[model samples]
Target chain A: MSGVRKLVLLGTGLIGGSFALALKRARLVQHVVGVGRNATNLERALDLNVIDEASHDAAAAVAGADLVLLGTPVGQMGALMQQIAPVLAADCIVTDGGSTKQDVSALFRQHLPRHLSHCVPGHPIAGSDLSGAAAAQYGLFEGRRVVLTPFAETAQNALEQVQTLWQQCGARVYTMTPEQHDGIFAAVSHVPHLLAFAYMNAVLAKVDAQPCLDFAATGFRDFTRIAGSHPEMWRDIAVANREAILADLKACASQLQHVIALVEAGNTEGMEDYFATASRARVAWGQRHK
Target chain B: MSGVRKLVLLGTGLIGGSFALALKRARLVQHVVGVGRNATNLERALDLNVIDEASHDAAAAVAGADLVLLGTPVGQMGALMQQIAPVLAADCIVTDGGSTKQDVSALFRQHLPRHLSHCVPGHPIAGSDLSGAAAAQYGLFEGRRVVLTPFAETAQNALEQVQTLWQQCGARVYTMTPEQHDGIFAAVSHVPHLLAFAYMNAVLAKVDAQPCLDFAATGFRDFTRIAGSHPEMWRDIAVANREAILADLKACASQLQHVIALVEAGNTEGMEDYFATASRARVAWGQRHK
Candidate 1:
């Protein structure tokens, strides 16, 4: 397949900028345009060669572009889709690097109904605590997984083109329904962030919170590291993936209650069995993941 | 002050072996005898020079020893204390490397009533997933915190000797009552381990648990890292620190319920504030810790 003639990035932050940089390294896109509200970040992207041009107007930036990536937070993606709907080229393969799929899918249907055939919703599973154009790097997606959730009306060619582009950036691409993508991510990514935040809040609630934190060691550090995630970003995720998040949170709460009962009863044997199940599975996961 | 003439390590493992190694590095101990049920592990400790002598009998090993460190699990510490009580030297300083303190303090009182004045219980904050004599290292306690929970009857001279030994091993030492130590650790270390174990168990309860584990990334890895901890050891902790662990687990459960309510009601602003509170504190902690 031939390279993209022009590619526009809806948000010039880590995810979008990294995508542009990777595409540039792979020589899969001729010219890249980064659009964002942050002037300094856009300028930095240009200076760093993450994009060939920078634009403040999303609508103007997507005109005549063969590819557009919605890399903004889920809260901002609807308005972005609305902005580009009237200006996006007929054959442009529109996709996103959103964490959740269902909300982005609805946005696509609501704002870009006429362009549904060319629209694709995807999630690149390369999350980080860092952000901004400056945090972008060429190998961000290398050996990563990207899931594309295509609507029924989405053209096969458009879906394949998006998948191929991610593959060019050294990602392994998988296709799943939007619901599947949302459910899987809710279990793995979204729920863990929420749990970490909840655990942190619980720690903060202690009367001896400062001393508790002072004495916290490596175990506490690793367990609550994700609690330091971006607030508004995670908030949007909680709302967007509410149902799945709620289910997982409830499950975790139930698990915690069971643990309390075991400890309350001083049931060492039961606690051992409970912890052993988790420990075995976690050890197996580490072996596989590493 | 002066070095220990002879040090006896009961149930020699990672903690015991590392302590012996660090003391040797500081030239603060004349002789180290490692005692354990496992003959192979004892032999390994001797081979690694973590111990100058290997003994199968805790009682025999403590005979005429000036210092005896009960570096075993809380479960085994009671029996070892019983075994050594009859033979321990009059001025010998007995301490432990137990994670939970109150129970270890009780064990000392129950078995070594006459030796209470010379007993000082401590917890070294340098925890690792690795275990056994082979995991021992010279600098394991370097820059680490060692909390010593002394009995009211504990002699200042005995406490100072243990504190000075840890300081010589490159550790910062703090003193507290066993109750305070247990409460702080339950909030920080023990509860987090239980929570991670609960979270992992929750994931395992899912019908599609394998798929979820397959997609588990860095956040899941870090958040549930403690879930891979030794089950029997954690079970012992859960029993030993039951009251504190239960209190914190309940608090955590309540926090999760609040999060569930926020997401269920689509209260994005409320969720944002909740996440922001945790995110800010966690970020501040990372800055301080680094």
Candidate 2:
């Protein structure tokens, strides 16, 4: 109710660092504290003015904070919830910047006290291929969509406060169930990433057989650029959201099979028709959104 | 034996127009002539200074040019070659900016005069989702790779001249057989585009059921951006390089099957190992090249 005076951003990497920069630019909170496993990264966050102070102790960082934003990998959120549970204030709000929502929400429910209905799961759908505090920018969230998945028992006030924070940072907020969030992202975001990674892997596996790397063009670079993301981070994402990711993989494989069959069967007309429809739909979608 | 003085660029879209710009910036040609079906785009090319003049007549554009660059869709290259062959000078070096090399080379062999050993088939492995002369920039080819697939009968002096031209325009040139060129690109470029297009189509098909587009992020946008490229152009590429594209698709499908089996079997160790290997290899490859 005191307008979220003090904020602790746990795991001040790209997401958390960007959030801190946004908060500072908007002058939304009194103090911003950063917590991370690496002291060097924490120091870099402080040096870059992403936060007012840096601390390695999660408990100490969240001690008096009104908002604790968990910005760690999806697989690490559960253990972090337990570590910060005892130190979080009675009325403090807990939110996250993780990609998956189902697992994060479950972690909160299992670790945090039930009376602490301030847990609100949020994901700001904005990032670049670059990572860490050095890659953070002030307007990273501008004109981006941030989804908030609140449990049924979540405090109404806490949810509104979290929404306000995102809005002030220039993000359009959408509310959905955790399952729906994961499913949608699996189709649009997670699956696309996995596909890119898989594509690069397939090519690199044969790097010695052909001059694939030497002959790579701008198209290859752009398509596989994100494949260069943090391996540990992506591995966690793949495992944590295994079910939804597999569902997407199934859909993708079936689509690939259909195209392959059309080509193999010499169904030129059908193949052309398929590409035409996809091209038209995608072009229309891009024009509208861009 | 003299340096190229006049350059004629056919189908002055993104690649053609960009080539024109690069030639002008490098001062490699005295005049740049643009040929296209669309008068409006030709005018845009002239206004943007990508070309010194615009001509709708293919024969007139190639009449006295020292070099002619075909920049149309792969499907249209054959017709354009036939149209320009009669008027092209005996000494004029005709090359192409098409994606697939084997088919384009076949067209040149069929239509080009026997005296014109000057005809060399080429593909500049650079482009963006943007199209038309309006999207052209002078630095488009800087630091990009250009593949030149010369036939056995190709004049040695003419091949060297073409290589020098691309080098002057700030591109790294490499030589390969048309088959090797198509096969390598199918894995690194064509198949990736097909996968992106197919994946986007899959997501769009489910829009009615789930509205996944509403929550799409940068990852999805980047992955599917190529899907929005000219449908007719991609359609031509898919058909022209059918064999290599099919091979790449089969390989990708098998890789997806491995991932699918792991997920279905709930083999966490296998899944982790697969993703970790993919992520690590992709990251290393991306960093080295990108």
Candidate 3:
């Protein structure tokens, strides 16, 4: 129930900026320090009152902070962790908004072994196509789910504090091992993005791709929505969670092969049942979610 | 252009019902007769003024009709065509809202051989998850594209009538051979639906599928939106456009294999480029279309 005396966001982009703003609005944070290599984005965060101060030096920004959020892409988190480890207060609680968790867990063990108890690796399921500080809003995490993949050495008090912070932001917090979180996300989020990208390439490979795209309608719009995601970020995610994502991708490829065989053989009954199983499940899922 | 004197809908669902409403709004048709196995749905069409009369007999419905629009699953088209062929007027036009065209072209040749000159196969890209007569709306095809695949034997006058009728419904009409229309749709629409179904089945095969589904977010929602489509309808489309759909499915499988190799080798640069190609194109497409 103790408030953060100084909160630091190592990457003041959408996720980081929104978290800082939410905590500030909740009166749970006294001072927010925005740290990023993007000077303009960091300045925007400060101008938008998402942070009380802005700094390019992540190491210096966490010097006196009670809570520090590593909100950058997972690929950038390791170096930031190493830089801040030397300056971090002994009692400071560390958390992240990374999409993947196992790699971040490894980074925690490798760079901040002594601070494992203070590190709470989290993934807030609140991503949008928009990014950077300007995309930050006051309620980005409202009614969203935040998953914490806390390692074995994570302190109970640190975990509770991180959970409470997310709950204060109107996010429902769930805890799982880094492995479970990675596998689940690989199946649901990462695999779908990869398939969408693959499907887009399939269309592009066509000789009449331009005309086909011109004639594409609403169905194509929804199917390829994720294919339009940020490439660098997705590439990093695919590689970071390589094993789990690879497994899911292979599963998808195998399913696709089966579909190809059914279509090639003109197996109407089999194809119909196959399509029906997935179709029925998807409709059920949509209704349940609605 | 002369309007339809007595328009008959062979299957008064979304497509048929909507066309009737649009024609009624444009005052292009004198009377609209709705025909379907579902008496309740036909009654709804009449109640909504989507039709002036309801009939369960396809042959009886087409007896005095100057224009008969078959708007049911492609699988049901053959039976309805056979039923109405005996009663169709010599000068009457036969059209359809089937998604696939090649099979309907074949059906026109097989069951309604004498009426081939009057048969105008069309595909209105005005699909929605909601079907039934109650889902009919006058603006369903407003600004949408409707493709008409007229056979070699299709009369020029009949073609013009169908084209003019669609234009009056606020749809831009394009004419192509059934082969060309099937190829384009297989690449864009049919293949994507199959891929989404495959992706859904892949997720279902995972050990922690329930948890994966539970954690699925917006990316998953948009990616699988097409997977929730009508199973029987897609099955008919897949089987009807078997050759083209098969070719596209194999093309997609090949693309998936390439992606697997890229990820399996941890080819970050290749994967990034692959994703960037799709992302850039999709964004450009979104901008251009907007």
What C-alpha lDDT values do all the predictions have? 0.91, 0.81, 0.90
True contacts kept of each: 0.90, 0.63, 0.84
| lDDT (Cα, tens digit) per residue for candidate 1, span B131-229 | 678888889998889999998999999999999999988999999999999999999999889989998998998988888888878889989889898
- What value does the lDDT take at residue A195 in candidate 1? 89
Give the top-scoring candidate (TM-score).
1
lDDT of 1 at A176: 89
DockQ of 3: 0.81
Among residues 3 or more apart in sequence or in different chains, the pairs in candidate 1 whose N, CA or C atoms overlap within 3 Å are none
Residue A167 displacement (Å), model 3: 1.8
lDDT of 3 at B245: 88
Residue pairs whose backbone atoms clash in candidate 2: none
TM-score of chain A of 1: 0.97
Model 3 agreement with the true structure over B1-290: per-residue lDDT tens digits: 99888999989999999999999889899999999999889888888999999998888888888999999999999999999888889999999999999899889999999888999999999877668999999799998999999988999999999999999999999998888899999988999999999999998887788999998988899889889888888889988998988888888888888888988898989999999999988878777766
- Residues A185-224, candidate 3: write the lDDT tens digits: 9999998888888889889989999989999998888888
Each model's TM-score, in the order given?
0.95, 0.92, 0.95
lDDT of 2 by residue, B138-240 (tens): 8788888889999888999999999998887798998999988988888888888888778877886774434687667677667777877776787788888
Per-residue lDDT of model 2, residues A1-290, tens digit only: 34558889888889888887887788788889988888888888888989889888888789888889999888788888888887778988899999888888778889985634798999899856667877788888889999999988898999999998888789999999989988888888778777876787688667443477667766776677677676566666677688988978988899999989877776767777777777777777777678
* Candidate 1 vs 2: which has more DockQ: 1
lDDT of 3: 0.90
The residue pairs in collision within model 3 are none
